[model samples]
Structure formats: structure tokens, C-alpha cells
Target: MLAAATAAVLLLFLVALVMMAAAAFAFAVLMLMAVP
Candidate 1:
């Protein structure tokens, strides 16, 4: 039971990390387009 909970938490962390990375990438693209 503990292992399963740990796994779920890890998965959630990974998803959050990916989302943050995607947001950063999108922001960078928008800045590039605005500047040029």
C-alpha cells in the first residue's frame, strides 16, 4: 500500500514537471515572436 502511494506521488510530480517545462517553452516562443 505504501509503495503504491509512493508511485502515485512520483507520477504526479513527473506530470507537474512536464507541464512546467511546456509552459516555459511556450512562453519562450511567444517572446521570440513578439520581439521579431
Candidate 2:
């Protein structure tokens, strides 16, 4: 029971990290395109 709860929390954290990474990447691409 505790292990399952921990796993679920970890999974959510990983998903949030991935989403943040993707957003940063997309923002970088847009900035690069705007520069020139």
C-alpha cells in the first residue's frame, strides 16, 4: 500500500518533469525562429 502510493507520486513527478522539458524546448525553438 505504501509502495503503491510512492510509485504513483513518482510517476506524477516524472510526467510533470517531462512536460516542463517539452515546453522549454518548444519555447527555445520559437525564440530561435524569431531571432532570424
Candidate 3:
């Protein structure tokens, strides 16, 4: 039961990380567009 809970937390963390990475990439693109 503990293992399952830990796995769930890790999965959520991974999802959050991916979302943050995607957001960062989008922000960078927007910044670049603004510069030009």
C-alpha cells in the first residue's frame, strides 16, 4: 500500500515536471517572437 502511494506521488511529480518544461518552452518562444 505504501509503495503504491509512493508511485502515485512520483507519477504526479513527473507530470508536473513535464508541464513545467512545456510552459518554459512556450514562454521562450513568446519572448523570441517579441524580440523580433
Candidate 4:
């Protein structure tokens, strides 16, 4: 039970990290387009 809980938490963390990275990448693209 403890292992399952830990796995769930780790999975959630990884998903959040991926989402943040994708957001950053998109923001960078937008900034580059706006510059010129």
C-alpha cells in the first residue's frame, strides 16, 4: 500500500514537470515570434 501511494505521487510529479516544460517551450516560441 505504501509503495503504491509513493508511485502515484511520483507519477503526478513527473506529469507536472512535463506540463511545465511544455508551457515554457510554448512561451519561448511565442516570444521569438513576437520579436520580429
Residue lDDT tens for model 4, 1-36: 999999999999999999999999999999999998
Better of 1 and 2 by lDDT: 2
Candidate 1 segments exceeding 4 Å error: none
Instruction: Name the lDDT value of residue 8 in candidate 4.
Output: 100
**lDDT per residue, candidate 2, 1-36, as tens digits?**
999999999999999999999999999999999998
Q: Name the regions of candidate 2 deviating beyond 4 angstroms.
A: none
Question: What is model 3's C-alpha RMSD?
Answer: 0.4
lDDT (10s digit) by residue, model 1, range 1-36? 999999999999999999999999999999999996
Where model 3 places Cα greater than 4 Å from the true spot, the runs are none
lDDT of 3 by residue, 1-36 (tens): 999999999999999999999999999999999997
Positional deviation of 30 in candidate 1, in angstroms? Answer: 0.3
Q: What is the Cα-based lDDT of residue 15 in candidate 3? A: 100
Please give each candidate's TM-score.
0.96, 0.98, 0.95, 0.98
Q: What are the clashing pairs of model 4?
A: none
TM-score of candidate 4 to 2 decimals: 0.98
Clashes of 1: 0
- Cα deviation of 33, candidate 2, in Å: 0.3
What alpha-carbon RMSD in Å does predicted model 2 have with respect to the real structure? 0.3
